[model samples]
Target: MKAVMIREFGDPRGLAVVDLPVPVPAPGEALITTEAVGVAGADVLIRSGALAAYGFREGHIPGGEIAGTVTAVGDGVDPAWVGQRVWAFTGTGGGYAEQAVAPIGEVLSLPAGLSAVDAVTLGSSGVVAHFGLAHAHFSPGETVLVRGAAGSIGIMAVQLAISGGASAVAVTTSSTERGRRLRSLGATHVLDRSGAGGPDDPTGYDVIIDVVAGPDMPAFLDRLNPNGRLVAVGAVGGQPPADFGTRLMAAFQKSMSFATFSAATVTAAAQQAVRTEQFAAVDRGELHTVVHEVLPLEQAVVAHQKMDGGEVFGRIVLLNSPFH
Candidate 1:
């Protein structure tokens, strides 16, 4: 089996394609023939050694999200899943291979009419969007302000918020063209961060989903309604200012809640359920996964570079060229 392994974390170029023995399913696990894998920001962080303090094991594969067909099932796993197409959230990393073993609980059958590419694109991003909206306890007629609206997770958040009966205000750094794309994805209003008004004046929102943290946090907190919630998913712009105390005090005084999410803490069952729901929405034409580009597995380096360069507007999938 061909796999992209990070023998030493340093840069995207450090990911090396090497031949390795195909992974076999362990107890309660299933071996999947990798079809499509989604590249995420965490993967890039892991590769660049920025997350080295977190103690990720060396010689590990880097992908966290994958969709493929099951080829084998391990002891305690039902053989019925063996030929089923499934999507999985491999939290620690192992999806960037021809064949990867995933715990049965982490895998979900692909809902009718969802393609492998789309399924992979949804990955953790879709699940996180669902969780964030649920955490905010949004209701019909409520309003949501989503930062990084043109990105994968942002787009998913926009669609999910709208589906949950909330109005979505998406903020993006992309051009007017991309803002139109976000609007088509269910954003009631698309605000360009690079434009005149900026992200600060997000008036009338009951909830704010800030995927791009840093200075935007204070701006978003200012826009939140009393008793509203702010869900922080990513910090694209380095770290927040050291004097974030003022904003924290404001949130407290306003009775607003601040929360964060990561796939590591999200249970497998929850992810599977969200995946199922998202797929159903896609089938019904109520939800869509925006895939910006697809590259062959061997071109994984290019995909990583694109993501790191902030050039990708949505999910970038790596296809298992050898298996295809």
Candidate 2:
């Protein structure tokens, strides 16, 4: 099988397409013939070795989310799953290949009318968005602010917040077109992070979903309502403030709380349940997976390049196209 492996940690250039033995499913697992894989910033960070502190190793396959079909089921796995189309979270690696292995219990059967491409885009981001909204205990009629609104996870967060009956306000860079796109995804308002029209008055929002952390932290903390909850899914801008004192003080003063989500923090069962709900939402026409582009698996390098260049609007998927 051909897989995208980070031979050395550096840039997207380090991601090499190489031949590797197809993995067989172990007990409680199933082998999936990969059809599509979602490319995101996490893949770039892993390739650059920035996430080494998180246990990501060099020479590891770099994909984390995938959509594929079950070809075989291993011992202790239900035989009925064979030949079923499913989407799964491949925690660390194994997604950027012709075939990947996932625990049967971790796979979610694609809901009616959902395609592999769309399902793959839901991946970890959608699940995290769901969890963030759930953790916030968002309710109808309340407004939630989503930082990095144009990002993959941010976009999903916007939609999830809306689906949960809350209004979404998104903060993004000076990209009017992207702001419009986010509004279409359920964001009630869009603020330009690069310009004067910034996030509105602090303490106005019921929940703050911060996907980018940096100098904005102080202002974001100020904008939270009393008892507001902030969920940080990623630090697209940079690391969190070195002085946790100021941020913690602000949170305490406002009676606010913060939470973080990572693959390690999510269990297999939870992933499956989230995928099922996401797929159902897609099927019910309540949520849509916005795919910006799709490239052939062999052109995995191009996918990484697009993501690194920040040219991708939504999800950039890798399909098994012969053109690659």
TM-score of each: 0.92, 0.92
lDDT of 2: 0.78
Model 2, residue 70: C-alpha shift (Å): 1.0
Worst 10 residues of 1 by lDDT: 194-203
Candidate 1: the clashing residue pairs are none
* Candidate 1: Cα lDDT at 96: 91
Model 1 off-target regions past 4 Å?
Answer: 194-204, 250-252
lDDT of each: 0.80, 0.78
Clashing pairs in 2: 202-223, 203-223
lDDT of 1 at 312: 80
Global CA lDDT computed for model 1: 0.80
Clashes of 2: 2
How do the residues 172-210 of candidate 2 rate in per-residue lDDT, one tens digit apiece?
A: 545889878887777777776732354453336778888
Model 1: how far is 302 from its true place, Å? 0.2
